[model samples]
Target: MARFFAAIGLLNLVIFSTSFLAAEEEVMTNSWHVIFKRDVDHQTAHDVANRNGFLMIMPMLGSKREYHFMHPQVKSNRKKRSIRHTKNLKLDPLIATAVQQAGYKRSKRGFKPLKSLLDEEKPIESINAFPPKKGSNEEDPLFDKEWYIKNTGQAGGVPGLDLNAEAAWAKGYTGKNITTAIMDDGVDYMHPDLFDNFNAEASFDFSSNDNFPYPRYTDDWFNSHGTRCAGEIAAKRNNGICGVGVAYNSKIAGLRMLDQPYMTDLIEASSMSHRPDLIDIYSASWGPTDDGKTVDGPRNATMRAIVKGVNEGRNGLGSIYVWASGDGGPSDDCNCDGYAASMWTISINSATNDGRTASYDESCSSTLASTFSNGKPGYKDAGVATTDLYGKCTTKHSGTSAAAPEAAGVFALALEANRKLTWRDVQHLTVLTSKRNHLEDPTAHHQWTMNGAGLEFNHLFGYGVLDAGDMVDLAKDWKTVPERFHCTAGTVKGVYKFDSKNALKLQIDTDGCRGKKNQVNYLEHVQSFITLNSTRRGDVTIYLTSPMNTTSLILSRRPNDDDNKDGFNKWPFMTTHSWAENPRGKWILFVTFSSESEEFQSGNLFEWTLMLHGTQKSPYTSQTSPLIHNTKSKLALVKRQHERAAEFQF
Candidate 1:
């Protein structure tokens, strides 16, 4: 029998006695959440909860087994109920017992009360200075200021250290029929430069629970983050006022979920899933706190949404998600962020105008590629020129925040080039086409090494900067990659300690090939799960080496991070530096406490696991056939190229 919370009699409200509280008595509300066995229905779960002493129970949105329930009276000694309150009252175990007696096993469970996951995320602000105008007469007035799109020695930017968007644009691939959703605070859809391609039908304001995804505060400096991001991807081409976007003809929608007073996991999930059918690319510039000490990512609902989007969106072509690597500077690692590390998202970092890593870019092995953005540390830099709040234009748009949307715009051009590309196909093309050593001076000292497949990779710079022309060129002829294969190594369990003078090492061996035909000769991502205890996490440095001797400095010591709390509790660090490596040999993980400060003590490595995700050596038929669609697309593309060539003829 299914148990529906709505069927419960009027969902009775029980008020407890307030006199039992102190003079400064706090309102203690008690509730419990549980995920019953999959076989159990809503009615049965309701009965189970009612029999277990829950006074009022309600199901969580989108989940039938999962529910939220309230007790008749306060049992704990706190002003408000918390995870501790639930534990102290033994609510989790009690609910577990009740569900078990009801003949259903709990496949998923949670004890902590659901609260706002939004805490700390600062937008990367563009520097105050603007670049000089060097665009030709036919170009947008501010086009020369967009060093990230057209780096032609303007504003001290190294020539050619850009996305090569102009080259793609010159070929008439200006992001037609592509729609990217800016999953940020909000976007100024009416801005003159953005209005032409604004996707109002796909827009939604989850922050305000409205249909229009517009900034709440039109004049506020912070409200412009989304607009700036949108401008980077789809600002109108040759608009005369502001600079052009990477995909100037592409459409963009704003899914307003961030910048609210409180953002729960459900809101974020909704934002991520909103109009997945319509939004081809989901561009997000925000994530967990980047304070160098915090480690977090999307919660349960949001994770489900991410998986769903990639699996079901775009009629199974898969939605392309572009995420900013982070702005936590040298101290932070992008691996700590779940969204950036996920295979579903293309994590992007930032390079400065001078062809160097941006000062605020967080280094990590998970970063796939990067693009030019703003200034570097100790150097005056010119930021990206883009649309701002209140129908204004600004020359200051910087950070990985700006880098993500720029990548999104470039991707739109790729989608236009060939509409048959899947999410994985896009990543494969990026890795194959991204440039290396384009930076005038890479700030990170790690030298680039050839992975097992002979692809150059650097921990700080990712595969390298995204080459718009190259990606589009490759994407046009790109066949979908072979079937994806995932393999996990044995888990390492035990407490171990080490320091700079003595590094602790562990090795796990693997057979690169899984089945007879599905050998993993090339790599897409390498994930390392580490559960350890440390007195000072900032003191720890980790290195992961592939069988090919390609080393990734996974963790770098942060001088400012002195938090003594538990460090890296079952955190998964990912790396793309091992691309194309044969996974057949032993992989080594090196953990060392490098800080000499006495404040840092030795740590314990309780357990670790290594998971590899990559493509098979042999091609296989995919569940979805893109070839039929590509056939038509190829014809259209050839026609366009020929027409473009004729137009260019003198």
Candidate 2:
């Protein structure tokens, strides 16, 4: 095959010349990220980093005048004196954007330790011979192998599929004063079931810049992936040592920022704005390399620290982040992962203790739900029993990195049963208490459709699974879901082409912005953005649809993306499968190409807009009872309370 594509083009030019000489020796000895000019204050950007010999080093946590300096005679053989000190700190008129830091690889969506029964030395009461059931006062012993917190189907799973988390721990909602950070790679927080629910002042260690986010030990423990996603979110109940978490009195922050030798955007904007006012659920489970040809995401100060941690973290009642919708199964396609197709990250995905799906999940439409992980290959005790590294224990934490800390421990038991739940009221109580229980999609491509408002989605398990006692019983009567707006609705602009048998189809029409200040009736996250170019950008795909027609396969088909040079530029591409669906008139989109040998697929698009998001009132009329009678049988009792809040069945 032409000498096997010239030995895969000389092993991709020696792995791109050893990752461009280790990113030019870590940008000639690290630390730069400047950005000053908001009237450059902080002691005039600390006296212009001590008049340029630079040293400063801190100021960036959650940005806004950014900082991080360091110079000291630029090392690794001074790459042209670190490109002339980043071109004289961007020709400093009080600098406004400097950079230098460059690493980016991420990956860790768990799963590589197969050959199971966790290499057997049995004990944990000989792998579950029944016993610990009644009232289940869990003296840990791997809490009866945690069948994702109460599945009861022992090992073959499927009994009550799971995570009703003991009916949200029988309503007391154990996540007291919720915290949950665990960004990844360094948490073992002295693991005695995560040492008294570890929140060492909201932990730090942006990879050894330290304040002990622990886990560095080696011999293949491989930094126990943020201590098994911090024991699946705060492991410390009656802690006889191993299982029990999913908000077992939640608090666990340990943002070690991945065992670093790379990954940057100021270390993912300082582990997503570090203590977002004491971290109420960051979670992350690494991203980008699900490898169906890496389309990556989040750059530029980790997209302004996830839009300043969802518009001014926690104090603004926002910071919920959560991610990991990528173990790239079906040949990778988490909307080509821009941080799990970010609408400010919630993403999740990965069902299994019998709810199916997880063979490394990743089927996109911007995920939104699904939890539990470990299953499929031979299934014995399936996997994911938490805490490891030194204070050891593990039923081998499987992927979607153990399902985004089990949906950040069921959103820390719905933020401890609603300590005023807002990051869009925990994404509208995870799309009105996520449920379609027995997940599915066992290769039946992604089934459960239903959108134009009668909810039920699924591009590989979304609007489903995660039901910590029905999302803490609809986050204790949620009501905090109005305000968010968005609009845009239509655009299109210029260049359009097609291939693999024509197929381009576009149309817009919108009214979602009708008389506007960001109007948008009902739909929660639509996005679309785009910009395209293709010719084999993983044989394109796209889709969209809804003016209540609901199609939405918003970008899929990344069969090992054969990048034909930087394709999608604007690239937003989100979709909650048109959530409440009423974004005014006609909207179709298509774009297709999943190549069936048309000799040279194709693409182009160039632009598209759409946007929409929701809430101009009626989040089901703020959970009803405004003395009901708004006629037409109160709009059929708010469409049966929006189909029992989309089947959460209150």
TM-score, per-candidate, Cα-based: 0.76, 0.33
lDDT of 1 by residue, 331-407 (tens): 77777677787767899888887767776788788888888668443333377788877667766567788888888
Clashes of each: 6, 0
> What TM-score does model 2 achieve against the real structure?
0.33
Q: Where does the lowest 10-residue lDDT sum fall in candidate 2? A: 14-23
The C-alpha local distance difference test score for the whole of candidate 2 amounts to 0.74
lDDT of 1 at 112: 11
Q: How high is the lDDT of residue 307 in model 1? A: 67
Clashing pairs in 2: none
Q: Which stretches of candidate 1 lie over 4 Å from their true place?
A: 1-79, 82-139, 218-220, 375-381, 440-444, 513-519, 596-600, 618-650
The residue-level lDDT of candidate 2 at 408 comes to 89
